[model samples]
Target: MAENLATASYNRRHDLLQRLRTDGRLDVSAIAEEVGISRETLRRDLRKLESQGLLRRSYGVAYPVESGAYESELSARVDSNVEEKMRIATAAISHLGAAQNVFIDEGFTTQLIAQHLPESEHFTVITPSLPIAALHWA
Candidate 1:
């Protein structure tokens, strides 16, 4: 009986992952109903998946985590959305007002923002990313 219960739990979690992959996201209450489980049980399964880095849960929805190995590479991300990222970078810089110091987060878009910042003696840019620091250092 214990073994059967364990198998059932494993099967249910696997099915939940498959559904999240196919649909891109799962509605918590709806999925619980469809899978014949309580919402609490589904929530527990979602939490487990989140802890495993297989999925992320937000509000009442769960989304499968896309493989980050390729997509997260700086070279790949920098080439993917040049125009949109540039526009965002420009907009972000425009809102700086009279700030003498700026903190840029580590990401491709933030890198673009660093590139777009005007050459000014009064501005001091701070970033934790090595690439961004190297770009500005020279």
Candidate 2:
């Protein structure tokens, strides 16, 4: 039951994020009108999204993070390939093998892959993208 609730909350947040991608802002009344949720509910959802690092909000504004605020250049590139990046990230993780030092390109997509890396699967990654490095450490 808890998992289901989490999933529902996640779905709501994901949908809201996608909307922000296209619209640049999440108006409470508009969100209620479009999503069929009450403004209060949408406000709660937005608050959760803000806390989760999915977005930043103030007063009545929300914008997709850009450049350094988002993924690194490598992560951005990898995100572009979607399936291929996923496959590569998944496969490359197997090569980690307790290695302490790593290198990554200055690409956002590549850096995004590193962000998702497991904490227990320890490795030090060297990357050209500051965002990726921050993501790894974050």
Candidate 3:
């Protein structure tokens, strides 16, 4: 019984994070219905996510802390599937050409490219994100 309840809680939290990742933000009513849990229970989950620095609660809504153009939180995006991102970045770099201009977006996957980008004077990189700019400059 105790173990079952703990497993249920773990599943709920995992689902909650997945929902946030897919939707960028969540409303108390919507998430409660989606998770098939009471509002109070959902609030407890939100509180836990907040404590983990994954999200922010405002009024009846919870928004990811790493909100960007895609509405996903930066920290959450970077921390999720790190190895996959690295693999993707490596694949993308293989297609790069010398003496060409490139524009990278601010998405999580694109940020990996910025991190793994080779040091080259031949390619010009343009990005609007300060963090990516810093990465390139560094």
Candidate 4:
């Protein structure tokens, strides 16, 4: 019985790692449901994976460590947690009180921040990404 349980656990972890690699990120609840396991069980499995440097979990999402040269495309990242990103962006703008210049990084979340920036504010925005620069222009 113990051996069977161990095997089951091993299989679950393997499945999760595989999914994370393919998907780039996994929503915790969605993965738990797909694997037919409780959220708590999945979390435990994720914890093990994190300890092994196989993945990282944040805000109910599991992201795989880059084992190869593979990286998730920006469009895929932009589509994930869009609502949460918008909320974060809205909150982030509040911190820019009376700043004359702002530097935005190259990431989907930063792009949302650029979108949420108040049009009334006359700050000079600087970014290396063309998409973010275009937002300021528009």
Candidate 5:
């Protein structure tokens, strides 16, 4: 009996993912209604899918990465560097004052520098170890 219940749950989760593809996006209430399950149950199913990185829950909407065309679009935007980070750093450095403090928040590009910074390009560096604070040298 437990096995049958588990199988039914697995089937329900599978069906929910497929339905999201056709539907573009869904909310827990709507999915619950469509699948004839409780809202809590649908929420649980969506959570499992999210843990697998197969779906994203934003705001009140659950969207399938491929079906909604957002996953690939976001990846494309992030893939191309366009030298934005380098350009910004250059522009920031152009303004010259003897002593000034600047900070860039923790993010992907800055984290790389934190791990390994070039010895040649010099500046009065000020960072709260923008990647991982603990790794900062004393």
Candidate 6:
């Protein structure tokens, strides 16, 4: 019975990870219902995934971590927590003082920050990305 339970646990966690990978994120209540597991059981699965560095969980959501080298390619990362990235970028803008020098990186999140920065705020923008530099023309 113990072995069976362990196998069942493994299968459930595997399925949960597969779901997260496909959707980029998972809703706890929805996954628990779909997996036919109790919320407590699903939470345990999420915790195990967290320890594996396969995902980051917060409240009712689980975000997948692409394995190795932070996985380059904007197309690969854009779908991952897009809303969260936007929120983070917007929050970062709040920290900038007006007319301060800001160095934006080339990552997708930084790109979002560059795009979303309010026109009312002025800054000396420094970026290595051609796309961001092109913003000067827009």
Clashing pairs for model 1 are: none
Off by over 4 Å in 5: 67-138
Q: Point out the worst 10-residue segment of candidate 1 by lDDT.
A: 67-76
lDDT string for model 5 (59-109, tens) is 668998664322223223345573775565455455434434345445544
lDDT of 4 by residue, 1-138 (tens): 999998788778877888998989999998888889999999999999898888988999999896643334687587879899988998899999999899998889999898888888898988998899998565
lDDT of 6 by residue, 61-114 (tens): 999987752233676678889999999998998888665788998988998889
TM-scores for all predictions? 0.53, 0.46, 0.51, 0.51, 0.45, 0.48
Question: Candidate 2: TM-score?
Answer: 0.46
The per-model lDDT (C-alpha) reads: 0.84, 0.71, 0.80, 0.87, 0.62, 0.83
lDDT of candidate 3 at residue 75, scale 0 to 100: 71
Model 4, stretches more than 4 Å misplaced? 1-70
The most accurate candidate by TM-score is 1
Cα deviation at 44, candidate 1, in Å, is 22
Tens digits of per-residue lDDT for model 1 on 1-138?
Answer: 999987777667778887888999999999899888999999988887788788989999999986642133476477877999999999999999999998988999999998878886357778898878887555
Residue 35 of model 3, lDDT score? 68
Candidate 4 — worst ten consecutive residues by lDDT sum?
67-76
Please say which candidate is ahead in TM-score: 2 or 3.
3
Clashes of 4: 0
lDDT of 3 by residue, 53-74 (tens): 8788999988887533223457
Ranking by TM-score: 1, 4, 3, 6, 2, 5
Clash totals for all candidate models: 0, 17, 3, 0, 0, 0
lDDT of 2 at 114: 85
